[model samples]
Target: MEFGLVLQTDPPAAGVVALMRRAERLGFSHGWTFDSVVLWQEPFVIHSQILAATERLVVGPMVTNPGTRAWEVTASTFATLNEMFGNRTICGIGRGDSAQRVAGRRPHGLASLGRAIDAIRDLAEGREAVVDGTPLRLGWVRDGRLPVWMAAYGPKALALAGRSADGFILQLADVDVTEWMVRAVRKAAADAGRDPARITVCVAAPGYVTADDSPAALAHAREQCRWFGGMVGNHVADLVARYGTDPALVPPELTAYVEGRRGYDYTHHGRADNPEVAFVPDGIVDRFCLIGPPAAHVAKLRRLRAAGVDQFALYAMHDARESVVEEYGAHVIPAFARP
Candidate 1:
């Protein structure tokens, strides 16, 4: 199994180079950057400094909306980066979020994404292919081709990514979703004349654990939820609508449920919150985040690994919670990194 780090929004650009160096020293294999201008500098451009600073650390954008850069220009940009770095370039694509709104393009559907993947792969692989009847070609050759990762959620897009991409990024999925996507990707790979097992499945989720197990842990879980509580990512509203049979908006029970559990940790005294309990109804936050003692957290991660997560990208919402950026580099990583 592999582990990766996510560079948060508002991270100091000045310290990015140093952070990359520290990550390298800490024995982390990869540093995945999120693409959000409102957060800070553009992920790809910021990654340039990081790529220049470190040798072994694989660095790339976790996701960049396709609307911002066309397949041709995107190929050119990443190919140039790959030339400089030799083989450490990954291009991840996702539906336009707020970043897409900034660029004034609507989110893409599964068909659009499937087309984009074909076009981008064509450009990255140096193939003379026509996308949507547009003849496209990247003249430059890439002896060491860059990997392409698609961040997808819906079944259609997941299937497309499964068939086409070098890897897939799962943002809001639990072990169940991750398992489903991995199986889908493997089947897609087989259908595309590629080895299904070759594709990487990177499971990303919120993880923060405190050795003390105090009020701070509960507060940390609430703090984490405050952000996720309102995250209306791709198909979120749709999933909630279709599945939210008894929408919380007009429930028989009072607002007491949200008020109480909204601030409760998913872990109760080092044990997982009862999945049977309707704490949040939707199971959105509870499924993906692990906030508890380190032992319990690692045990839950073992279950995720058993479900086929090749790499677990621990998303640290509050750095103050556990200082995993240090602890992972110190304790957790060494144990996992060993053969």
Candidate 2:
């Protein structure tokens, strides 16, 4: 399976670029950044620097929302990057989250997300599409190649990812959940008359390599990554609201953990010390993150790959960023590379 790193685009843009460069040298194929403009640095502008500096590191937002910018602008920015950087760009999108909520608006519905995906993918790929009721196409894009991946948690969003997106991005790394969701997407693809094998399955989560699964060490690892469960809770809460508490509507696995989740604080979103994430239990953190040694990680990743995962992206959102990347490069990544 391919490996990628998800960064938050924090502080010095150069630091972010350096991390991406390091990741590429260490064998990561993709570099993704959070696109919450208000909370972090803009990712597209940074994507240019990342693509320019690296030989083969594909870069894009881990997710940018359709509500934040005009569809044409998003498509054009991607097309421009691909034009300058040898078609090494991918667009991972979703219904708005921190990017929209922090700006005092609700996230856009799935319908808008579908339209934006269609327009952006078509325009970037040198095809005609309609955006905002006007027929449009990127006149300058001759051979732009951009793949649109959709991030989803709920069934409907998963269905949309299967039916429309070039790939599916699942932000958690639990093997059981990954298996179930991958089946859901592939089944939806088959039902829609699309090639199920053509869709890529990318499982992204925080990964911390430990020497052993000792309770103390494991406890520390969980603390460093518990923020992820809370970050995901933002989406799970929405699912509960829309689909209700019925397991038939939403999987019990996704909604059960969020019972104690009173609310989330965007100020601490995706950070290591998100105090507000106390509602998230240790079980969820351990289950959601890859928190053991290299061998353990390899085992879990193998299971996910067997379950049809094409790529596994690590969210370097913790204290052990360099160590995790280095260890994976040295141990975990090589295990899966072609013989």
Candidate 3:
């Protein structure tokens, strides 16, 4: 399976660029960043630097929402990057989250997200597409290619991804959830008369490599990655509101932990010490994140790959940013290298 590195465009844009460059040297094929402009820096602006610095690392938002910018503008930015940097960019988009909510708006519905995907892909690929009843095309784009990947957690979003998106991005790494979502997307693709094998499956989660599997070390690793479960709970809460916690519709493994979730504080959205995520239990952290030694990570990755995961995007959001990347580059990545 291919490997990718996920980061938040935190600051000193150069730091983000350096990490991407380092990841590229270490064999990460893709570099991703959080795109909540209000919470963090603009990812597209930083993506340019990342693309320019790295030789072969593809860069894009771990997710940008359709509501934040005009569809044409988003397509134009991507087209410009691809024009300068070879078609080495992929768009991983989803319904609004911190990007929108922090700006005082609700997440856009799946319908809007679905349309944005088509319009952005078509325009960036040098094709004409109707956006808001107007025919729009990036006239400067020549042989430009942008694979639009949709991040989804609900059934409707999943169905839309299967029927339309070039890839599916699942933000967590639970094997059962990965298996279920992959089957859902692929089945939807088949039912929609599309080739299921053509869609790329990317599983992204916080991966913290510990020194050993000792309980104390494991506990520290879990605390650092606990923020992820809360980040994911923001989406799960939405699912529960719509799907009503049905095990048949939404897996209990996903919904059960969020029962104690009172609410979230965007100020601490993806931070390691987010007090708001204290309600996130250790069990949820263990299942949602890759927290163990390299061998343990390889074992879970093997299961994920066997479950049809084509790529695993490691979220280096904790304190051991460089160390985890180095470990994955040295131990985890080589374990799956093709001869």
Candidate 4:
């Protein structure tokens, strides 16, 4: 499995080149960044910064929503980046989420995505381009054979990706769910006359190592809820339901949170009064995170690999422990992704 690291927000802004260089030295094979505009930094800008600095590592934003930029426009951006960096570029897209919705519009229909991917592929292939009646081409050798993948969740999207994309990224779900999605991808690929084994599976998950429950560590995990809250409620609810407490005592304040009705600011502080509630809760840390020690994190990755995961764009622990990451760089990274 290819092991990758996705650093969130500020840490990415300062010393990103150095950070990527360090990751490379530590044996990481690839790096990804979130493209969501508001909560984090713009991924395109961050991706460009890192790719420009690294020579061997495969780097790209984990995804950019179509709503943020139209199909043709997003295609050109990817093509330009690929041209500048050789073939080590990947372009991932997802159904419009907060990352796209907050920007303006959502990627409305499946047909749009199909057309978008088709348009990108066409542009990359340097085929006759009649984009809205305007002819265009990026000089064959092709615009750039960038691997394009879809950020997949449910059946419909997975099937769509199977038909079109070079691969797919699995976000915020358990191994069982991933196994199911993997099967779906394979099934769809077969129906499309393509070999199932070729579709790359990249997973994004939370992994952490807190030797003991430290205040600083616990707090950082809680802060990640700023974005994770909505995910638990919407996408990972099945896993959350299995691991969470009587959703009855979910702090009442967190109800709006689970319902996606709360704002980022309110959601973070809303559950603060009962902060320890999650840290000490039966399944919170385990279900939502792989927190314990290096062994626990390693075990989690092993389980995922067993489920047929090909790559992991790890969003480590809580971005709280620099030491933990350094230790992980020494231990965990080598085990999974040795560049």
Candidate 5:
């Protein structure tokens, strides 16, 4: 399986560039960032720096929403980057989340997201597409290529990803949930008369490598990565509201932990010490994140790969950012290397 590194585009843009450079040197093929512009810097601006600094790292938002920018503008930015960087960029997009909510808006509906995916891909790839009843195309884009990956957590979104998107992005790493979602996407693809094997499945989550399975070590690891459960809960809460905690529709392993979720504070969105995340439990953290030693990570990754995961994007958001990248490069990544 391929490996990718996920980061939030915090300030000191150089630091973000440095980390992407290091990840590329250590064998990460993709570099992703959170695209909530209000909470963080503009990822597309930073993506330019990352693309210029790294030799082969494909970079884009872990997710950008369709609502935040005009579809043509989004396609133009990506096409521009691909023009400069040899098509080394992928667009991982979602309906909306922190990017929209923090700006006092709700996420665009699934219909809009689905249309945005097609319009962006077509325009970026130098094809003409209709956006809002107008024929639009990036006239400058020649031989440009952008693979649009959709991030989805609901049935409609998953079906849209399968029917239209080039790939699927699942933001958590639970093997059971991974298996279930992969099946859903592929089945959707097959039912839509698309080749299921052509779709790439990426499972992204925080990966905190611990020294050992000792009680103290494990606790620290969990604490560092627990924020992920709350981050994911933002989406799960939406699912629960719509799907009504039905296990047949949405797996209980996903919807169960958010029962205690009261509300989320975007101010502490993806931080480890977010006060709002107290509702997130340790069990949820363990299942949602990769929190043990390198061997343990490899074991879970093996299971994930068996479940049709094409890539594992490590969200190095905790204390040991560099070390975890090094550990994965030295231990976890090599375990999956092809001869």
Candidate 6:
């Protein structure tokens, strides 16, 4: 399976570029960043620097929303990059999240997301598509290509990812949830007459490599990565609202922890000490993140691969960002390297 590094485009544009360069040298195939314009810097602009710095790192937004920019503009931006560089660009998109909510807008629906994906893919690939009731196409694009991957957590979103997106991005690393979502996406693909195996399954989560397996070390690891469960709870809360608290529709493994989730604050959206996420217990943090020795990381990743994960992207949201990347390159990555 391929490995990726996810970032938040936190300032010092140069630092972001350096991280991607290091990640590429360390064998990470993809470099993703948060696309929330207000919360972070513009990822598309940063993608240019990342691509220019790295030899083969595929850079894109961990997820950009359709509501933030016009579909035509989004397609053109990606197509422009593909033109300058090779077709080493990916578009991982979602309806909308902190990017929208922080800007005083509600997240969009699947219908809008589906429409944007079609338009972006078509336009970037040199085909014609209709956007905002007007037929549009990137006239300058010739052999330009952009693969649209959708970040999803809900039933309908998963179905949409299966039927439309070239890849499916699941933002947590829990085994049961990963298996269920992967199966859901693939099954949707089959039911939609699409080849299930063709869709890429990317499981993204925070990963931290530790010194030992002792309870104290494990506790520290969980504390650093606990923010992930809360980040995920934001989406789970939405799922509950949409699909109700039915464990049959959405696994309790996902919904159960969020029961104590009183509310969320975008100020601490994806940070390590998100106080709003206090409800996220140690168990949820352990399951949702990969925090252990290299061997342990390799073991869990192997299980995820067996369950049909095409790639495992590190959220890189904690303090051990460089350490995690280096350790994965030195040990975890080679452990799973295909011969």
The CA lDDT of each predicted structure is 0.64, 0.92, 0.94, 0.64, 0.92, 0.91
User: 1-339 in candidate 5: lDDT tens per residue?
Assistant: 999999988899889899999999998999999999999998999999999998889999989989888999999999999999999999999989999999999998999999999999999999999999999877889899999999998888899999999999999999999898999999999999999999999999999998899999999998898889999999999998998987878988987788899888898888888877778889889888998999999999999999999999999998999999999999999999999
Measured by TM-score, how close is model 4 to the native structure?
Answer: 0.78
Clashing pairs in 5: none
Question: RMSD (Cα, Å) of candidate 3?
Answer: 0.7
Off by over 4 Å in 6: none
Residue 200's C-alpha lDDT in candidate 1?
83
lDDT, residue 137, model 3 = 77
Residue 201 CA error for candidate 6 (Å)? 0.3
lDDT (tens digit, per residue) of candidate 1 on 1-339: 677776654457856667666877787778776675654577777777888888888877767766767777777677777788876877777776656554555676667766777677667667766765889787875674778888865555666887778888877436665666677777777888888778888877666666756777656564554344334222354343334424332221222234334222222211222232234433455565666666656676777778777777766555442366666677666656657
49-130, model 6: which lDDT tens digit per residue?
9999988889898899899998888989899999999899999999888999998999998999999999999999999999
The residue pairs found clashing in candidate 1 are 162-185
lDDT (Cα, 0-100) at 73 in candidate 1: 76
Clashes found in each candidate (C-alpha, N, C closer than 3 A): 1, 0, 0, 0, 0, 0
Q: Against the true structure, candidate 6 has what lDDT?
A: 0.91
Q: After superposition, how far is residue 293 of candidate 3 from its true place, in Å?
A: 0.7
Candidate 2 on 268-319: residue-level lDDT in tens? 9899999988888888887788988899999989988998999999999889
Whole-model alpha-carbon lDDT for candidate 1:
0.64
Every model: Cα RMSD to truth: 7.0, 0.9, 0.7, 6.0, 0.7, 0.9
TM-scores of the candidates are 0.80, 0.98, 0.99, 0.78, 0.99, 0.98
Better of 1 and 3 by TM-score: 3
Clash pairs of candidate 2? none
Q: Which regions of candidate 2 fall more than 4 Å away from where they truly are?
A: none
